[model samples]
Target: MKDAIEVQLIDTNIYKSKELWQPYRARGAFGGQSLHAYFLLAGNVDRPIIYTVERMRDGKSYATRMVKASQRGKTIFVCNCSFSTLEEGITLSHQVTMPTVANPESLPSDLDIFQKILRSTKSESKQFLLRAEKNINDNSLIDYRAVNQYSNEEIITGNVKTDAHGRRWFKTRGALNDDMKLHACIIAYASDSGLINVAATANGLSYNSESMGMMASLDHTMWFHAPARADDWLLYDIHSPRTNHGRGVAFGKIYSSDGTLVVTTAQEGIVRLTEAEQKKRRKQLEFENGFLGNCRCQL
Candidate 1:
């Protein structure tokens, strides 16, 4: 994870990606690497990305910086981050209770799960599972374990419905230094992982589903409530409240192993069905509109 998000300071208030990491079959670079910026466009891995940071505001208690990322002379992403000094005498504090989940130690790793499926599947299905297994083994930087396990059938079919709720334990594979800023960046990078997929999971569609047309994060927002280590076990509890008009919204809470709510995240994204499904939807809409039009004419 640290290596995947590495950046170098090239000039004053300017940074460049040391190495770009793109997910398997992703259109562009991972969103989490952008840190606190709202993504305006997707940056291609073929080109180098340049980030220019502008000092927005600097005060005694608070500071703000705006980061703009560009690739190939096109603006790709933008974000504003605000920082505040820790208060000496803090009083009021409350947080939502973290949901109960299986301990990371007790749960099977994602690689193990994929390998199990790969062993049982036939030759025809092995191709996809093999690719998935290889990606998890080679590129995955975080150790992830899902709270609820899906069967091999469900995994192969790409239709695992869980009522729009998902919980998983995740943390960096290697120990990180004691720099809180770096940890926060790690959190930001990890947060974008599979978040938009929560919307697809709600509708019984996985990334490998044939019926899934397009799924991309439109915007992402996250808030840090307390200090936490990115290398330690953390539970991510997420759920999608609604999905409509090719859009879905999900909210997530990240909790430390000791049940401290350390981070909150909200994201909305485009969740579209395949072309065949979309055509059926369009026909249905046309029928309804035509019926309404006939009623108006009679009136």
Candidate 2:
């Protein structure tokens, strides 16, 4: 939730580069820009490109393209996307239904929750301190929340379980009225938040200041089944499938109120660790969880 991108269109007549470039900070590339560019490029083609996609996948047709967003040209965010053919081929259909969750109105806003958490802390978890330091100062179009989170320092020190799948509560915090496409694009922008952590969770590792290295999103994927509004609250259900060979795969489902499946996402990331780092982490985990404790397993 901390890293989800938020953009508000200043003009309805056109979307600009700043709007497109903002959400892509998760990756080195700009996702909003790519989405804008994708729309622009598709508009230029002669054929009618009817677009449709599943919400999440990994390396498949509907997976990576939907999430790997970039800026269109220098200003617009174009999601590099393709339209589907209307041809009636081998009829195949299957899907996972959306889960039932609390309504947005029933749940506290992320900001409220964050403020409460900060106020309640006594010992001052280092991980929370780091997150506050890195994120508290920013102003953006969208508001994101990690539904259940420990501080960044707690995570690295093995004070918390890395496999505790993250839940990010999010929505736009502005008055801008976004259309279906704009909302979908915004959701795409926000979907990247906490995706990489699924792998880290499995390994009981965290990105601490003392550690030397890099953590970045390599590729992202998502699918939109039905229309969704970014201005409204959405519950993102995420999980990790595998973590091995210095890499991890994670997937998620976005559900609207009344349990409608709006979107899905999948991501693969590079999780590099030298033997020394792994040993250090193992030692830390052992010290926290105990000598016989299962550091690699979590609830």
Best by TM-score: 1
Candidate 2 Cα misplacement greater than 4 A, ranges: 1-16, 19-80, 84-95, 102-130, 149-159, 162-164, 206-212, 274-276, 279-299
Candidate 2 residues 81-167, lDDT tens each?
A: 543333366876566776554455555554555455566655355755555444444454567655556663464353356573666
lDDT digits (tens) for residues 1-299 of candidate 1: 66668889999999999888787656689852123556678778877799999998898987888888998888888887878777678679999888877779999987888777777767366546656666666667788888868877777767786568888899988888898878888888888777878888888887667677888888788888888899999999999999999999998999999999999988988888999978887899999999999999999
Candidate 1 lDDT for residue 244: 95
Model 2 lowest lDDT segment of ten: 39-48
Clashes of each: 1, 34
Candidate 1: segments with Cα more than 4 A from true spot: 32-36, 130-134, 280-299
For all predicted structures, in order, the TM-scores are 0.89, 0.61
Worst lDDT window (10 residues) for model 1?
A: 31-40
